[model samples]
Target: MEKVRQATDSTVEMPPATGRWKLIGPGIVAAATGVGAGDLVATLIAGSRFGYALLWAAVIGCIVKIALAEGSARYHLATGSTMLDGWRSLGRWTSWYFGTYIILWGFVYGATAMSATALPLAALFPILPLWAWAMISGLACALFVALNRYEMFENVMKFFIGLMFVIVAGVALLVGPNLGEAVQGLIPSIPEGSAIYTLGLIGGVGGTITMASYGYWVNAKGWRNPAWMGIMRLDNRVAYVVTGIFVIAMLIIGAELLYTAQIALSSGDRGLLDLDAVLEQRFGPFVSKLFLVGFFATSVSSILGVWHGVSLLFADFVRNHIKGETGISREGLETTPAFRFYLFWLTIPPMILLYFGRPFLLVIIYGALGAFFMPFLAITLIWLLNSSRVPAQWRSGWLSNGLLAIAALLFIVLCINEVIGLLG
Candidate 1:
């Protein structure tokens, strides 16, 4: 009954969204969750190393993410089921893989996200030590997410997205990017020694595990039927457009400011710190401080988005698998005990890794699982959307199939690259 075979008649008869513009919460949340501080660093490092030669890769990255988010949301809207419901229909193996992956992924990601958010704060305030700031940041975000409903969480994320747009994009303008060269960079050509960065920009722009949660967020926004399909697509595409702007802005700043000066930044979240120092030295203290605020906005939004969205995902998994609730899925995932428990899992347990370094075996497993998730999502989505699980009217067309296939191939390469690094 969870398969969408019976829903075709009602799905086809549903009316169009009255006003698509106003129906734009989940997409914004998805974008905020997807474009984190690490994503900015990867984009920045690419530009710093290769200037705008990889701009085409950044542009393509957004397009790929649009396909992914659209496919995920389409399944939800068409079937009126969560993504977990679709995956469950495939077999038991999907559950086994996701169960192992989400637990390990959350444990590792919790520490990484908290520390990322704390880095700029520690530099800005200098009152708390880094681990103290990380702990405080984790607890504060947990409390905030715990108290708020989806609407509050969404509004705050919107505010942070606005904050990021202004600061990061404003700084990009201040740096005076080379327009003519940027235009040239739009053509798809790889520079010497730029393969890894291009692959990262293509694969890691919007999200990893959080991509699977787009449907949960879509359901949370009350868009449960196929009538909402038009608005959902609009929301998904616009979200990635904003994501494109954020990454492209960072790339511009890197190319204009760091590339020409022959300055190389440290990799990972610390690279943004390096950019902060560069901003202060070149522009002044105020600009650098503003950039740090943007960095915090980026990190904090991602932390909260993951906390809220992925918790909904875990809650849905529990509802369908353990409880065996096969009736029409309720929009109650956010309120479930499983949701809060996962939130606690995300916020508390990982703080230990911040003080004591991540255990080697744990890191290896997490990295391997994290690397494989995108490919798994892409392949499984293609299968689900094309199979009888989704309604025929809303099944994968040529365009969706094409984009997802490309994503699968790209992600497979990235996963291999990740596993090799983890092992070797």
Candidate 2:
């Protein structure tokens, strides 16, 4: 009920990040978590369908996410509060929305992420069935997060991002991209009926709810004040730039390997598997296996990230709203009962979905609720950062405002389409 002032804490270290690249952690986590198998597959599909015609949209997508992630992280660094705290200050509606979302989304996504991650592992080693692999991988990821601290989790994510980079970039290069046509695509041309397709590429660039988790990761990494803002920006930018490049690489693969060859890939996580099979046929077993390894990294990264980050969010949500108790910092939410509970929620219960198909009603509800999360996050960030809830100097400038506004609009479009598809 009181407006807190001052952006920086005197006790926190304020060292310059001039030559300290290794000091960055949260951004890498955000990047790894954001660019999951779904994002990559979507990009690959775009490339396969339109070749390099939509390259500029992928680039712009990264820029949009950079703004959103940076805005979320900046709010934390500048105000010393989590996004949830800011959202709570807005209205009680924020609480209800997130409460429903984290529950349904986590339940459904647990099965989906496990299934996606398991697909490659199952393909690699046929000894186990997909459902068993899904449960094992999901539980294993939850265990790893529950056992380790953010420091260790971040290190593992770094490895995964690195693996993703090497594999996607390698495949892109191996396909020998056409520099000239790619340059032409940068000018932005509408390829007939590709409006919705192009929008999906832009909207699905990095991630959805994970962007809201950026601040928690920021706090988890000891960036609890505005002093860390400079390095945080640099870290956020570099991560999404790498994300952009990674998507671009996938696009190139789709263009050269799939588009030119007149190959079609399925949509969603299965699309990555389709790509892997295509790679095996076209490039050989080694290349296909390498892509599978990368696929494992991408999906696993998403699992670990959602397992940890969203748990922290749920913990905070429980702390302030459900429990009606406070005093726990956002950074400190990782150790809470609610945190571990959500982690378990993400791991075990979803295994049932892996066996019995998701209930049609449940799936529809999940889709309808999950669709608005990004729009909710973007709009809320815009509200919080532009209000007096943040320090005067640290509030969003016109450029930041513009980007957040654009992100909110774009996500709303995506939300509408998804909801109509689900309910219609």
Candidate 3:
């Protein structure tokens, strides 16, 4: 393939310039943020419960992410509008759904993200309490977002993503995972009693609401037009490819080590915590520590990414809708008051949840809404990207559409399973 060029324009109205790696920015961060503790737990659980039976699903998850991320990037490139702006164009109902979802998702996700970041910290430093570490993680992530330039955050995320991949891939290699079983998983059979977890792994590994923020990241990276479209696709593919490998490595570790050892994993993020213990038991304390460091890097990168990226998205939603500032002609959303307001919402109010712990009701609602968000994003992207609004040059190809449709269906099934699980 010919090398795709980068975007040159800083102003919102112009098309992004041509070049490679030149426009790298928050899109990568958003990708990192979308893969959090819950995702890891889901992937690891699939591995532990059924070895490499879901490995193919995990790879499929990566492709699904690439499609969604590409759709988001295309939306921004074609219209030079944020995804929020595109949705608002659809109608007020879209805005209402988005607004309510963000408020609820942010409130609950803040606690969960922090707790995840803190787990590795607590594991590394027993001197500090888990709650204390959680608070510190929250405050630190918020402060990082508030103080730093977007480029700085992106570089940090890139570094951590590299570190995460190295550690995870290394462990997977060291464990002698069953490649034969892993290959078979690509065919997509549903294992008995394991459908729920398998679906969750497929849906969860792909992305979260943060994936919708891909445009903002692209915008931040100076990708402002159709010229940058090729590079944007490459960037999305590379990021998810790396992410897929990391997840597959985790699954292999689960299969080779955890399954072989016969360790019964718990249900949520705690299962990952349990995995940490099992690592120590099987491979010695040093390997466990290394895994914890990788785990901490993964979680903290996620916290910082969400704190920064989605805050940008929510802020843009407010700026575009409530403030009536939409399109490329206006000032960027990052500097708008609505952006700061959501930033504060992400940082300050969630501190309450940090101390008090998420209420049972809030957790339940968060799970239900959270489970449904992927399907919503997929369906919305398909609708919005295919609409007349998107420039024909940047429209998704049939292959992309097919992948995204499969993504939407996978998440729909996952959402159904979640609702059933929650209700039952």
Give me the candidate number with maximum lDDT. Answer: 1
Full-model lDDT for every candidate: 0.87, 0.86, 0.78
All candidates: CA RMSD in angstroms? 2.0, 1.5, 4.3
- For model 1, residues 224-308, the per-residue Cα lDDT tens digits are 7887788889898888898898889999999998899989988789999999999999999999999999999999999999999
Question: For residue 394, what is the lDDT in candidate 2?
Answer: 91
Instruction: Please say which candidate is ahead in lDDT: 1 or 3.
Output: 1
Model 3 earns a TM-score of 0.92
C-alpha lDDT (0 to 100) for residue 190 of candidate 2 = 74
Model 3 spans > 4 angstroms off: 1-27, 328-331
Give the clashing residue pairs of candidate 2, or none. none
Ranking by TM-score: 2, 1, 3
Candidate 2, 1-78: lDDT as tens digits: 635344455777675647758777788788779778888888888888899999999988898999999999998888
